[model samples]
Target: METGAVDEASIDSLTDFYLGCGVDGMTILGIMGEANKLTGEEARAVASRILKRVDGRVPVVVGVSSPGLDNLSSLARFAMDEGAAGVMVAPTPGPAVEDRVRGYFHQVCEALGPDVPICLQDYPQTTGVPISVETILTLTRDCPQIVMLKHEDAPGLRKVSAVRNRSGTSETPRLSILCGNGGLYLPQELARGADGAMTGFAYPEMLVEVVATHQAGDVERAEDVFDAYLPILRYEQQPGYGLAVRKAVLKHRGAIACAATRAPGPRLDATDEAELMRLIARTEDKVKELSHGS
Candidate 1:
């Protein structure tokens, strides 16, 4: 069955969450764990479900961060077959990082054919490695299907410079560079040249508003929104409390079923929970004031 960008069933729940909250795109983290560890067939099944649920109402991008080249290719192919708008591939660390990563992408591009767009997941902190700007340029030049770059580097200006520099090159193609720093330096990054952000915070509306306002050329308005949400962003960055805070805010706003995270992650303490609630209350007041005035 043919699927539209936003109408896929597997991601309908998330898509509904984002659309209702006013986000332009939806990014899903592929959990490769015991229960959810998906084979190629299983991945396709899940992707199919997501496509059906979303019903093409929004663009769905899946994370294809498997450990091996084969796994990455399979997942990318599965997502493409199931109608994902794009696939985000994380860099694999090794002596041959560039070669392996580039080769994996080449294989996936071949398997999925030329039309499937891929996003380079440049998450240096989590991946323990990084893809240089030269590498990005080479990949984009060689594979036209690789369209976006999800940059999660700290001091994100580096990534922005890389993209801008690449764009300045002769015969360079336009590629979307999305900030993935979870709102910490979003405004600055956007000002630098980021197209958008792909974060995991509960308040997608805040992000959507910030990015849209910035893109619309209202720098002052975007800064105001960023400043208003600064408190929540700061609180979420507290050590040993980030994800807990995210889940708390999500639950407070009635966005998710629970603040439950996979094991090995810490649970929020009373103090952390109280802080999260306070941040949410303050943000709510500011948002309400903005809405009334607007």
Candidate 2:
């Protein structure tokens, strides 16, 4: 959930909802989670609060990406002390070539030390710094701390295939690849070779089910389930505005106290809310139809 002046009761409510949905883990302070909009104290308080509530029920991963490695390491250390399973870092946006990117992360890994497992977030769309497949592979090869990849490159199916193929053929330590385009291409990502999804769709149960269903070897059934939620997924993929849509849906579902984001974040006007509700209604009916084997 987006951090704000929301009280403890609301935090507990949101945590309960996500727990009920059976998410393998929770990622706090992510891009969708509005990490940038939060004050440092607020971010730490939010992380510590969620960690306490979750209480080892599931692993909690924190996003510690920052402009300076010291800030990243500080946040990472605090999260680790707070019992985070890992911390995620994406390459900072700027004019960066592959070697420069690699060098930056190399410094990041060194600063974080080997004790902290890292999730290399590869969302080029947001960062505006594209990480080539080779760079990712090289990082995995060299950085023993990198334990997972949050792959969110659009038109990224081939990248998934390339990474997986390289993993199979090479001697590098294997990294778990989780796609993050709001689960839009979930079916195809799984087909191409994603281990699972780390994207935020309001209904995380959908992502959990899609991954489970696809991995069960029933691709057709998986696609059916995916197609049902595709509309809302697409609607929620609107760049800067999507977080509001997600928060609104969660609020509508009674999982949060307010759909309002921090100031400077997008607000859903009546028209936007109506359109979102309409898509949500259609998604519900479609999900029900699939469940009934129609």
Candidate 3:
């Protein structure tokens, strides 16, 4: 959210909100942080400020995906030197062939080197490059530096299972598989062997609860929590307009100061606001009902 300027106070306030929500890590400048819109210096500054404010309370993952590998490596190094836990990278955007996608990640491993752990972001819908399960296994086997996978392939529940099965059977080191896609398929992904979620949803507590409940072996209760918030989750998953909606919800919940986006963003009209508030009200009631065991 922009308040005519980017200031430390707003950043700290946001950090406080997420920290309060009990996130294990914070990812900045990814698709949700408007990474593509930020200039290099601005991205670095935001990363530095958040790293400083967080003060080692939790791990911070910086998005270092860039069109040029040099730019990507530089940002990754900067973030690591500034004490970030690790960096996340996605395949370059294009209709890339599968072999080319595998080659790109091999280059990525060389660029990031072995010291810096990597989270391979397999967000096909956004990146237009799909990394198949076999390719992922090969990469992780070849490059032990790959420590995590941000799996967001649509209708990819079976893919999750396949990866986990391979990891269990193959001699390659296992990568932590975290689901994204606004957490829309989180329940199924988790059931299919995903480790957790890496989404930018405004209600992180719900994600935490769902993962925790499911992991606790109470699948029905996990779905109860997920179902309570699914309406708002779906409403906030609108492709081009999702970020604005997320910022608005965060502002409404007092996580940030404003819902303003930088340039080239959509504004919520009265009707949009009315629709969102209605969903919010319904979500609140549903959550309450679930909490009361109704």
Worst 10 residues of 3 by lDDT: 1-10
Please, what's the RMSD in Å of model 2? 1.8
Per residue, candidate 3 scores C-alpha lDDT tens digits across 226-254 of 98999999989998888889988988998
Deviation of model 2 at 282, angstroms: 1.6
Whole-model lDDT per candidate: 0.72, 0.88, 0.87
- Best-to-worst lDDT order: 2, 3, 1
lDDT for model 2 comes to: 0.88
**Residue 134 alpha-carbon offset, candidate 1, angstroms:** 1.3
Candidate whose lDDT is highest: 2
After superposition, candidate 1 runs with Cα above 4 Å error: 1-14, 30-46, 96-104, 238-240, 292-294
Candidate 2's C-alpha runs over 4 A off are 1-6, 168-170
Q: Candidates' TM-scores?
A: 0.84, 0.96, 0.96
Clashes of 1: 21
Q: Clashing residue pairs in candidate 3, if any?
A: none
The clash tally of candidate 2 reads 0
Question: Which lDDT tens digits does candidate 1 get at residues 78-138?
Answer: 7767778988777666654777767866776776678778888887776677677778888
Which one wins by TM-score: 1 or 2? Answer: 2
